[model samples]
Structures are given as C-alpha cells and as structure tokens.
Target: MALILSQLFISLILSLFFSLTLLPHATTSKANSSSEYSITSIFNVTAANHKTSQILSFKPFHNQEEFPQTFSSSSSFKLKLYPAASLYNTHHQHKNYYSLDLNASLNPGITTGTSNFLVQIGVGGPPQKFYMIFDLQTDFTWLQCQPCIKCYDQPDSIFDPSQSSSYTLLSCETKHCNLLPNSSCSDDGYCRYNITYKDGTNTEGVLINETVSFESSGWVDRVSLGCSNKNQGPFVGSDGTFGLGRGSLSFPSRINASSMSYCLVESKDGYSSSTLEFNSPPCSGSVKAKLLQNPKAENLYYVGLKGIKVGGEKIDVPNSTFTIDPYGNGGMIVSSSSLITMLENDTYNVVRDAFVAKTQHLERLKAFLQFDTCYNLSSNNTVELPILEFEVNDGKSWLLPKESYLYAVDKNGTFCFAFAPSKGSFSILGTLQQYGTRVTFDLVNSFVYLHTLCCN
Candidate 1:
C-alpha cells in the first residue's frame, strides 16, 4: 500500500519550576560497592505496525560539513552500563521539574527535555550547581545563570560569574577550545562558544569543567563533562548533559576504552527498553565501547540487526535501510532506542512491495477507517488500525501485537509512538517502535540483538 504524506506545524510548550537544596549524600553509592550493577529497565509488551517510511530521510544541508555522515555495516557484540549522574535536589533550590528514577533493565535515569541540574562550575573550595541539559547530541555542557545577560528564567539557578569564586575561561588560542564546534575567540581573552539545537533552541557561553557522577559497572564515579557559563533551552530542569558521545569521558568514550556493553528491546508497536553493562578491572587495563569504533560519522550508530519475521515468515530488512548505534566493550549489546521512521521513497517502496506480495491477510482491528475514533478488537481497546504481523530482521518472526502500536513518554524523555504512511501510505518504525524485550548493543564486537519478544 502507498502512503499519503502531509505536513502539520504544531507548537508545544511546557512549564517547570525549581528550588535548590544541598544533597546529604552525593557520593554514597559510588563510595560503597564494586559488585556488578544494572541500570533502569522498562520494556513494554505490545505490537502494532505502521506504513511509515518518511521520517528516515536525513538530507544533506548547507552546514553539511558541520554534521557527520552515516553509513551501514556490521561486526561483533558487547554491552556496558554506567551509572547516570543523578540530577535530584543536590543544590539548595526549588524547581518545578519531575524526577524520574533510572531502571535496571532498559530506561536510563535521565530527565527529559529542557531539564537542567546545578553543579559547581569548577573544582575548588565551594562548589555550586547550575541547571543544564545533559544532551547526548551535544559535546560541551554549560549553565545559564546570573552571569548570562537576560538568561532564560530557571528558578534560583543561573550562571552568575560574579558569584563564582573560580570562573576561569578557556583561551581562544587553545587547540582544545577550537575543537568545540561553536568555540570562538572573544575580545575579553576568554574562549566563547554558542550551540544551537535542531529545534532552533540555543545556548552560548564560556567553557569550563565540573564533576559529573555516574555508575561505572557498580560504583559511582565523578567524571568531568563540559561546563558552559551561558546556556538556554525551551524547558529547564536538570543541570547539564553528561556527554555520552564518542568523546573522552562520555558514555561512548568510556565504552570505547573499557569495552562497555548494553542491550535494548523494541516492540512491534512503539515502546523500548534497554540495559547497560560494564566490567573494568580497577587500575588494570583500559576499556571502551567496542561497537563505537567506526561510527556512522553522524549522530547515528550501528547495531547488527539479525532479521525480522512475521508468523514465522522471514522478511528481508536490510541494514542500509535503518540507522543503529551499538554500545559496550566486547559482549552482547542491544538498545531499545531508535529514532528511525519510514519516510524515504526507497524504504516505503520496500514495505509496499513486501505487503503487496506476502500479506495474506488485511485486517482492520480497531478505529474507524477515517476520523479520530477508537475501537475494541477482541476485547483490546485499539486507537487506529488493526494489527499486522511481519518478521523482524531475521532472528525470530512472531506476531506483531495490536497493543504495541500505542505511545508513551518515559523518564529520560524517551517518547514512543507509531506513524503510519499519511492517508494512504505505509508506516515508519522509530524509537517509538522499540517498546518491549531486552535490546542489546555490543560496542566491542559491533552487533545488535534482542533478548526476547512478547508473545500474543
């Protein structure tokens, strides 16, 4: 079936408040144990299919050089997990933000969108916490505060340079400063930088450093991510992003060095779950995420997809059709996280042909053919269309449940939903597509695997 495409513009805004208070036990978990631990894991079970194949079109734009290029291929497996830095009430203040805990199975302990945290700018006598987004896409991290002129209102937290005792800025001439995409030399002898998000939100500031905490294998450890003096976002709650990219101390970086490993689970509908694992001998050898060695160059990574099948029928889903990011050192790894959508002509063509040829049954499980309606298919409340079964990459083909087609938002701002082809087209599988089972990514070996699937 061909899909109809349409464009709709919608503006969404949410409000949050903040209050600051000092944390009693900042280093409690890290200072105590060394046994293997797990991160958050919340994988939903359900299945729905979409004729969506349009959201995957990542075109080349003007600043193409600024962005990385991604390709597809495969290799081994590995998994690793790091304790995400906590962004609770460590600083003394009040804020209107919701705190979601991390799961040991799939979910990472990250507060979603515009949420910032407060932390001391630099290591010294008195440490202060500022609110910032711990953005995975971003490399350098900074805070918006008193020092930044007319910074966005984020409760009591602001990067007030005048108030900080040790506010040193990077020099424009420094090679390290130039490495930042937005870094520029300012007239005031301080390195200046400005970063803009895809949604047009931006943050500008000077560079600095601060301690960030995350569970490494079992114990909590303080690592330094970027620190910005001036920062901005549509929403504000957390302090700043702890870089998880391929940089030195970020999650990908750690996985690369220590060969960290992890797993993720995706469902036929649109929900996901994951688990991160890491095992490094203290002061023994180096470890890193094995899967990240030859990344796609862009924000996307690769996880060796085995196969997809429906009702025991194997379907041919190529690796080139979707983007994947593998994590960990040298073990089985998976991720229930993916931002893929079926939008491209080539991808849609594949789905159209697949269904046109192999689909033996066309069932409309719920909802009206037109309009925003709802229905109950065999006792299950359904929103849109009925359930269609097809095989995944090739591993094990099973029934794509109808309930998996719904959507939800998780603690880390991980949102899952299904987008079929417009009025008459196919559907796209996205992060919202991976909802159940344990998805694993092996950075060390470079392979993607699903632990198990929910049966209907």
Candidate 2:
C-alpha cells in the first residue's frame, strides 16, 4: 500500500506540470473581465517584411486616482526638468561635448548628443513611470518596451505593453502612421517604425497609441508614440526620449499645443529642477523674435540670427553666414539638448577673435577640448567677463549672462569659453547659452520669446 501511494503522488505531480504548461501565459493580471493579451515575441513572426506580431485592446485605467480626466482647453501643466546627471551618482558634474566621440555619420540639419535635461512622465493605463530625455531635436518620442530583442540597460523596469490595459496598436491605414519616417506596414496590418539618430543610436518597434499622464495636467488619452522592442544606444541614464520637435508625431503636435515654454535654471548641482509649461502665455517683458521655418527640415526651431556682439562690438562676419540657404543648409537652431553654443566655422572664428581681443588683459591658457579660448584667472575673483549678445529678428539684442559664455573647468580658476564650431554650416544655440532665461515658442504666431534671467 505504501509503494502504491508513492506511485500515485508521482503521477499527480506529472499531471500538475502538464496543466501549468497548457495554461495561457500573461505578464500581468487582466484589468477587467476582458481577455488577457499574451505577450507576442517579435521573433515569432515568420514573414520577412513583418516587424511585430502583437495586438492589444484599449481599456481605460481601472484606478481613477492615477489617471485624471482629460485636460480642458485653458488648462496647462508643468513638468519638472532635471539635469540628466542627477539620475546617476557617477555622472561627471560638467559634461564637455568635445570629450565625446560622436558618430561621424551626418544627417540633414540634424545632430545628436547626450541630452542635458530629463523629465519624468507616466505611460500606459495604470500610469507606469518613466524617465525620458527631454530633447528638442527628436521628432518622435519613444521608449524601450518588453520582449526587447536588443535594448540597452536602464535603471527602471522595461515598459511591458502586455500588462497595460490602454495599449492599442496603430493600423497601417491611419494618417498618424504615415507621419513616421521610413515606416512600413507589417504583414498583420500594424504600423512599424524605425528611427536612426545621427549619433548611430537607433530604435525599431511598432507604433502605438497609449495613455500618457502628466503630473499636474492629469492625463491625455490615445497619445501616439513608439513602443520600441529593439533599441541600442548610449541614452545616458534615461529610459527613452521625449521629442518636443515641430513634427506631427512630437508630444506638442500630438496634443495640438499652440505654445510651450521652458525655463532652464542656471545650476550645476544637477538636482535642481526647472519648469516646462505648455500652452502658456508669453512672460511679461519678454523680447519676441520672428521664428523662421526650414522647408527642408520643418521640425527644427529656427530663429533669425542677424549677428553676434562681443563687449558691445558686433563681429565682422558676413550676414549670409548665418542665413539659411534656399536648400535649407545654413541656419540657427535653438536646441535644448546641446550643452554649448555652436556656430559655423567662419562665423565662430570671427566671434572667438572678438572675444580674445576684448579680454587681452587676462592671462590666456592652452586650448581646452574644443574650446580655443581659455583663460587662467586663478588670482582674480571679480574679473569682469566680456558681455556676449546675439542680434536677432529686426535687431533685438538678446544679452547672455556670464555663466552662459564662461565655464569653470576646475576649482583652481581654469575657465573656458562655452562655444564650439558646428560640424556643418548650421549653428545651434545650446542650453548653456539659454540658461537663466525663459524660452517660449508660440507656434500659432510663429515667434520665439526670450526673457533674460527670468528663471527663479
């Protein structure tokens, strides 16, 4: 009888194992009575043209407290922008772009680098939090998703779409799918997207419409974005990127925002936060400049840069050096990702020479990184820096603060000018130059408003 009992127990264990294998596999619990969607691996698709095989149903968030109602017309929200270095303990306090070995491949009027600012937002139905790079150069926002075949290591858990109740795949026939560059329809009729940055970083995945929630403004439904299953890059410490570009797939365009404003605080502590306001009115006493559009690259934010001034003396560079050609070759772009101001080679030479001439009394140091202008002022505490200004739109002088143009390399008073020459003819006015200022982009009026030293 004892031998028969042992045999019976073994038989029961085999039966249980088989039952568990036959049961449906799910990453998370079902939201409601609806059927749970199984996570589909990208490798399961046999067709050569097919990218992804997953299909998801749309269901509202069960927790109402996590996702509030849709935003009203006049309602506005603020997102805190933190320095990218704040997320990691080992990140260097000062990031000099010249030290980086960026990719040599070039794209038209586009350059990529390690983003300077990061913003946190919620994705999916239950509002899974994600830290993303807040970049103005990216046209489409994307994040790493589960079932990732190739993905970089991130601090947070990978976004699992199968677990989200509000995840919906976009069809190939939708107009939004057409907005993606080099997008194609999978064999299952789902829209697939692939984006490659100039820095050799790329992501490939299916287009999705998911719920995105902001901390102060509640949540927006069916926001179009990329759920990347295959991704590779050095994305700093962020999970993905939030694109604020003018493209149709950008966050501002997806939400139909008429205006947006961000104030970058001048702080090296990395933990200090700044504010990014959407649909906000221009700040009082702000100077307005006519925003220019590059027909070839409409997603970029271009402003008329008439000239540059050092110590109140305008540099003697041809005005055409800053003008955009008909083919959209040369133009000035206000970039939030770039840490240092970059100008065309000839234009930069003139500006650098003018700065050197004005600071002749200060002792000069060897060129540090890409910066040709470095000064050793170890003994001086109150040395006056040359006032730097940019002439924009009909001769409006936008004065730059001292911290914008000067960077202290070390504690011993080795300072370097915070400017560089662009790889191409196009110039970029980076965040370093815009610090301690409020930058407002009025899309409806096609204007950019600048308020100096207004960030508190």
Candidate 3:
C-alpha cells in the first residue's frame, strides 16, 4: 500500500509542475488595477475557444515590407480575411470608434482609422497587390494612387496607374460616374469623385476601370474603382477601402453575387485567416432571420431585432425600442468593422441592469473604457455567466456564447460586459459578438442566417 501511494503522489506532482510551468506570465498591479490579462490565463478562467484565445494573444507584425495575400476557390470566389491588428503594427495607436454616430448626419462608411477585417487584391493588368479594408457600410472601392496630391501613409507601395496597361480613367459621361454621390467632371474630362466619411476621412480623385485579380478565382475586368490622388485620414497600415455595401457600385453588386457569406475567425495570429465567400450556401442548421431595409440608408444591412433575453428570460422593452423610424433614424445594423456591439441608451440600460442583477454577488470594478458593467473574478475558480440571446425576425433566437458577450479586461481576473451605449437611436451588432459564428447574407431571399461556432 505504501509503495502504490508513493507512485501516485509522484505522478500527481509531475502533472502539477507541468501545468504551472505552462501558464502564461502576465503583469498585474493593485494600484491601477487595469492590467491586460495573458491569453492563457484569461482562457483558463473563461473557457473560451482556442481561436478566440489566439486573437487575444496576437502579437503585432515585425516585418512591414511583407504583405499577406488571400486565396480563393474556382466554383465560388473565397477571399481570405485577416483581422487588421494581425497585419498592421499601427492599429493599436488609433482610437476605438466602434459605434456609429448617426445624429451627425453623415452616412456610415469606413469608421475612420479603425478597420477590422482586411482583404488583399491585385489591381491593374499585371496585377499589383494592395491591402484594402473590407467594409460593408459603403460602396466605393478606392485606393491611393501614384503622384498623390495629398495622401496618408500606407504600408504597401502606392499604386501607379501608369504601370498597368489595362487601367483606363472613366469619363464624366459614363454611367458609372453618375452613380457617385458628389461626382464632377475634371478639366481633362475624367470623372472625379469626392467622398467624405462621417469621421472626416475623405478620398478625392478620378474614377477608373481596371482588372482586379483574385487568387484561384481568376480576374474581374472593367471593375469601377477609385484611383485617389488626394486622400487623407488615419487610414493606418492599409492601402485603401474595398466597399461591400448594398449600393450599385459595391463589390458584391458589381460582381452580381447572388449571395454572400463569411466566417469570422477573429484571430490576430499572423498565420490564421478567415474565408469570405461569394455565392455560397449557409452551413447546416443555421438560424434564419429576415433582413430589414431602411430607406434612408439603403446600402447598410439592417435586421429585425425584436427583443433580448438574459438567462432565458426576456427583458421588458417596448417593440419600438429597436425599430427604424419613418426617416430611417433608428434600426439595428450588423457591421463587420465595428469592434463592439452598441445599443441605444434606453435599451442598453435595461440590458445592463439585468446583467448587474445577476452578478450582484461578485465584486464590482471601475468602468473600463466604454464598458460600464464590470466584475472582479479573482477569487472564483469557476463562474457561471448568464447567456444572452437576441430575438430576430421570425422569432428566431440568436444565441451568443459567454465568450462573445463577456471579455477579460485585465490580467487580475477583471471582466466586463462587452457592450456600449450608442449616442443615436440606432443600434449596431458589431464584430466582437459575431466571432466564431458564420453570418450568411442571402440577398436574393432577403434573409440572414446565423451558424453559431461554425468557424470553430
């Protein structure tokens, strides 16, 4: 009996030693009490999936000269998408503008310097590669061109239109020029476009038609895009923006894509990439929701968000809380660029109160950034958080996993509810809540499908 006990004790000690050694080292402080938790330690407590944990642990790129490219298949074009943080070292310096300010009277476009997913494409005849922000809110594919009058610094080399034999400047008389909002005719007869975003990021230059090549999916000829000679903003680390909105000039509309789908892995690991598919079917067992349209902003994707539930119990909010007004001032939009979900003030208050009530037993911490509801989980070994569910069109419940709605704010086991209050009447379902889910947009049928944890 003594010999058997000794062997078991030795095995247990070895296991514990290995586990302790494997734990990631983190820097913590009691004074400020706002330390970033190591990826391993946060995952250990939250039980988050490996993909999400990898995202939290991503390190900035060391090489600026090398650009990453996406690959595709033949039947349906599939471009690989990478989180902006993984490809650019400058993403950390920009302020987080995850929520849209619709009251400013500016239409939604690229939210200043904060772009989330990026796609790489080749422009011109010989196909010079450029990294562009994949945006779903606007529909003008634009990039900074050579001989720029004024341009912001980008990681890739400025695209020289003279180098590509297939590049042709669009004339002011062309139909494509008429599609632009504030288009004009240049002195040289070329079509000129001037677009100013809500955050003051503007791009002005001649519109052109060029051959854009995609890996494995061949090339698209005569695609209408902007060759900006004057562009300025905090557009760090990317060459330009590739609009995938519902406008006539959007990439999807230009390509005549029947349906589009994307699986956001949300990993900033340099090697990891997510797939953005054009003309693809939703995965098996997808929860379907009807797509809502707003006349004011027809290009943006709006969904019917009827109500919200916490721990399987519905919150008492009026039906008008998430409705779009007559002038299209209020609604819910699923945005790929926004970092965190934003709810209108009234609706947000109800949701926050529900979470606060459930977590009353836990220790409260100072509000972190935009998060007002936060907790300290340092002493607890295992914690059970309430599951959040969104009731969309057709009464379908879109369930959010614990990791999707709750995030570790520090290395000291401090966590915060991942939501913010919007300044306007509208609410935005941002990318953080879409992680590990496959969101499919079926334009033909006007439906959106959600496949939870499909990427994992």
1 or 2, greater by lDDT: 2
Q: For model 3, how does the per-residue alpha-carbon lDDT over 347-444 read when each residue is reduced to its tens digit?
A: 88999898777767778898865668888877765555555778765555776533565655444566678787876778888766776678889988
TM-score, prediction 3: 0.81
Model 1, runs deviating above 4 Å: 1-135, 159-168, 215-226, 229-233, 247-296, 317-319, 322-403, 408-429, 435-456
Query: What Cα-based lDDT does every candidate model obtain?
Result: 0.32, 0.67, 0.68
In model 2, the clashing pairs are none
Model 2 TM-score, 2 decimals: 0.79
Consecutive 10-residue window with the lowest summed lDDT within model 3: 13-22
Instruction: Give lDDT tens digits, candidate 2, residues 1-456.
Output: 886454333322211111100122343242111122332211111221111111011111111123343443236767777655445433334221122222121244354444566777889877787878877876788899988999877646789998889999999889989978889999999999887776677889999999887864667789999999888767646778888888787899998888989987733223444788888888776767778888888888887767777766777986666678888887788887566788888888888988888778778999765667988866653455555777765545676644456654433455677787888768888777777678999989899888864666
Clashes of each: 155, 0, 1
Rank the candidate models, highest lDDT first.
Answer: 3, 2, 1
Q: lDDT by residue for model 1 over 1-456, one digit each (tens)?
A: 122111110000000110011112122222111111121111222211111211112121111011112212122222221111222323524432333211111112121222212222222113343333433333344555444554554533454555544555567786656666667877887677776665455667666543322212111223223445555554444445434333443545532444333322322122112333434211211111223332323222433333333222344644443333343211111221222233224444444444334322322233212111122222222222222333234222222222343222211111222322221112233332333333333434553333323211
lDDT, model 3, position 352? 88
